[model samples]
Target: MDQPEGLTAVGEEQKVCRLQRSIYGLKQASQSWNTHFDEVIRGYNFIKNDYDPCIYKKISGSSVAYLVLYVDDILLIGNDVKMLADIKAWLSTQFSMKDMGEASYILGTKIYRDRSRRMLGLTQSSYIKKVLKRFKMALKTRSHSHEAWD
Candidate 1:
């Protein structure tokens, strides 16, 4: 690659610099990041899902954990709390990531969990509301004109 402006040496102007790492926003950045992440996660004994390349799972005896990847966002889910914490710690050492605690929302979907009942629910109500508002159909009251159809 050509030398960037303001970084060209006085006598080494003709010398091209080699990239030591992938730069963000480049065309190959996404692929480069995915490759690196896969290598690191696989080293930790995570197996990539055959059906979905973005999902990985790791199991040890009765403990199991899953890691979901989307672009730069990641969601870690599993039944074992200690395994999850270990994965999070390992990932932090591999990349700069902030722990958002328990996940409540992902991809515009709200997550509801009832640990006592072992129930989990997902809703896209917020996304649906946004779409309705965009199309100017988010009415506060039912219109009398549409009552016949109801």
Candidate 2:
């Protein structure tokens, strides 16, 4: 297929995504997905955040919902999960997605969410511990919220 101006033709983009735009430096590929995702969800009453439009919100009474996407991976957070599910289904129908429900790992960190408490937490404890052990810092017997390192 002939390559789109902003996108590399198939078999051309092998990890070296084309240089297309710049904020301070090159960063443009996300524009298409962001535009499409925003257009589709907004059609379903999902309003993209004004300050950070990439962050979308859907509200109904006491139910505040969220659907966030980075490139193709989606992370949903909400009190009324059913609405989120519906949003996901709608997005899938429009975008042809691979939905991996419930985020556990992202950006090299493990996420643990307790629905009952509605608390979200992220940690690289295993990773840090491995590093410390590699440098023999694990023997120090000091355990803090990873803040100790910082």
- Give the number of the best model, judged by lDDT: 1
Task: List per-prediction Cα lDDT, in the order shown.
Answer: 0.94, 0.75
- In the order shown, the candidates' Cα RMSDs to the true structure are 4.1, 8.8
Candidate 1 residue-pair clash tally = 0
Name the runs in model 2 displaced over 4 angstroms: 1-29, 115-119, 130-150
lDDT of 1 by residue, 84-132 (tens): 9999998999999999899999999999999899999999999999999
- TM-score quality measure for candidate 1: 0.78
Q: Which prediction has the highest TM-score against the true structure?
A: 1
Candidate 2 per-residue lDDT over residues 9-85, each given as its tens digit: 56666545344444334355578657777787888888888787657888989988887767667778888768778
How well does each candidate superpose onto the true structure, as a TM-score? 0.78, 0.61
User: What value does the lDDT take at residue 46 in candidate 1?
Assistant: 97
Which parts of model 1 are misplaced by more than 4 Å? 1-24, 142-150
